[model samples]
Target: MPLQRDASPRMASMLLTTYRALGAAANPLLRVFHRRRVKSGKEDVSRREERFGRASVARPQGRLAWIHAASVGEANAVLPLVRATIERGFKVVMTTGTLTSAQVVAQIELEGLIHQFVPYDTLPNINRFLDHWQPELAITVESEIWPVMITELERRKVPLIVINGRMSEGSFRNWQRVGGLARSVFGALKMVVAQSDADAERFKRLGVASAVNAGNIKFDGKAPSFDPEAVQELQQRIGQRPVWVAASTHPGEETQVLETHRLLTRAFPTLLTIIVPRHPKRGQLIAEEIAGFGLSVAQRSKGEEITPDTDVYLADTLGELGLFYKLASIVFVGGSLVPIGGHNLLEPAQLHCAIISGGNTTNFAAVYRQFNREGGALKASNPVELAAAVERLLNSPEETEQLAVKAAELVAAGAGALNQTLEALEPFLRQETSRQRTKGEV
Candidate 1:
């Protein structure tokens, strides 16, 4: 059901007034935030200037389309769209907020694509950024709603579209309390193309008249590419060991994975567990924890050898999930185990791995619904269940292969989101060539 619009004059005025006041202090507030983030190793210290609207690269002369994805997940989801935009002959400037995202984008090597750290959302920073890039069209991916940035884009008459837009029940409820503010922020968007019907309805309730369901683009995303030689080397090293990978794991979830490995190894004897933490910075600490647990471990970052005795392979590197997924027959998509919502299940699924996940997947409810319906994925609420699921797959290669086949088939069935999203956004995209030269014209 759509939400009732908050049309109270007092609420509208208060929301606008509050934002304007915050705009005045945004510069100082952002500087303090950046300092803290840098000190805590959240922000890249050398590239910190980019967060203040400073350009790290020169802007192209041709018409540019700007797309912003908040971090690695959002960045990956927007890659196909970025490729489509480049194929349209416009220079693409992609901005993201995390170091991991920056690293991942660097490996993509897409023509006409440039990645930058997004500027802080303040009036001054927004103005400086807009003036420098001067993008004719702006696309914000997922649910990164930056009020000041949207307000500036609206003021500058840039056509703004929110692609793959999502609003969870929890987020919708929070937005309801500040309905007027939500209206102001969401109102700046020319269109909000949601990933699911539920999200589209939520946008409509929040006063987004142009909300449309374009399907989830993650399903349309290209599978992660891997280096052939690297994959071959890793495969040779593993020999005939039973392998399972727990990928994109968060902080507390690592402990659960470690415990699950203990159970699996007891049954399989030579079972190899690979853990790829979401953040590579935690590599050293994770290695220490493995050693403390008396498990023989090898760190990928350190180029440690994965011998027969290596119980855990700490794939603490970036841009190699595809390699690990290909080597492992069963994959546990992490983050779901500890209420961090879930990481992308499609990655491993598309790579032909049997998928197992935890019970908490509110962020990807729609995707999970289809997976459950098709029996393409298994769910476990705790370490014991997780171990059992892995053990079952390891013991039964035929069952694992069947699950893998179903997962790949499921992904193949939902591969038209890119064309659908482009069809919906064609009007805005066409505006970019409105002033193009004719065949014989100079």
Candidate 2:
């Protein structure tokens, strides 16, 4: 809701009150929506109550820090923070919105970390969640500016800080249009630790009292992990084949990738193109697309083994991008080709794959710019360009290795953000520790 003209405080309250009432009234409809998602494999049926703020496991005995990360990317960025918080004597409960994110978090089993599906933003859900956890303070990772949660946290006097905060241009413009409402929500934040100066400035303009640029925490993250034995098995299966990977591809980009694969095969006859979709559920459709191109394809999800005749290998499984990155020396990070910002490049960079990306990486403007400037990654504006980049890299293995080294070096140099974030979070964590000790929670 846009805050009405004249910026009356009463108007903002009325709008929020109306929002809460509407959410309360839609309880039944929301249940139906949740059921539909479960049937579609979007929600975990066993843990459906978690979506309504019902806790499946009992809250632990110590002072708890609640972290809400909207999806995998944000979750990955905050992992180091989660570990550091645990090391500093705090139990952490991390929430993520998607099923895939829950799966990813499950794979990375940390001792003091608890994973829960994020409660819906309705007042009832938020209140129940906060009541059950009784968290010392709440933290959000990157772009998770839920208005109701912020408002409720403010009412309860729980400090809510945003780590690795990011504000995209389009989002900033939308918030600017509803200036007063934006102010009401953002003003409740204790602090916003932004990824870039531009993002910090944008948060400040939106009425966050404190916004600091702490750099992107993803840079300090370890590369996606894989079973080395799985990598070795795949290497044996792919022996002597020229392999190139298209990782985390989106729908529109995959069509182009299939075409590029078709073209790449003409020059390098033994080419093995691997496509890992951003959503693994799209694997079946992508496998069909590969077949429509009149190429032999094997889908990893179906336990199909890669064969000499296979032109494309659809790596549709989750938490295995590291395996594919290890197999392919040349990699193209996806979601950039069709203006969907971009996926994480640090994964390939850390895994020592020569990285290539589409031109639309506004979501990671600073890092992508530095990558291009340092010859750490190549930019392909379209499918034709992507094909050429792959062809060129395939012909020059030494150049590909050099690019990989440059990217990995750039990443190593960018590794201190996690330390800086921990330092910034020290004040809040310490205060909570002291208070919890008084209450016998420490």
Measured against the true structure, the TM-scores of the candidates, in listed sequence, are 0.93, 0.93
Which candidate tops lDDT? 2
What tens-digit string does per-residue lDDT give for candidate 1 at 1-442?
A: 4444554647776876678678767778788989998876678888887888888889998879999998887899888788878777788999999889998888888879988899987767778888899887899998888888887888777878999998998999887777777787778888999998889989888878799998888888889878889889999999999899999998888889999988877898898899999988889889988888789999999999899999999999988899999888899999999878888899898999999999988778778878977899999988999999999998899999999999999999888877889999887766543324321265
- lDDT by candidate, in order shown: 0.86, 0.88
lDDT of 2: 0.88
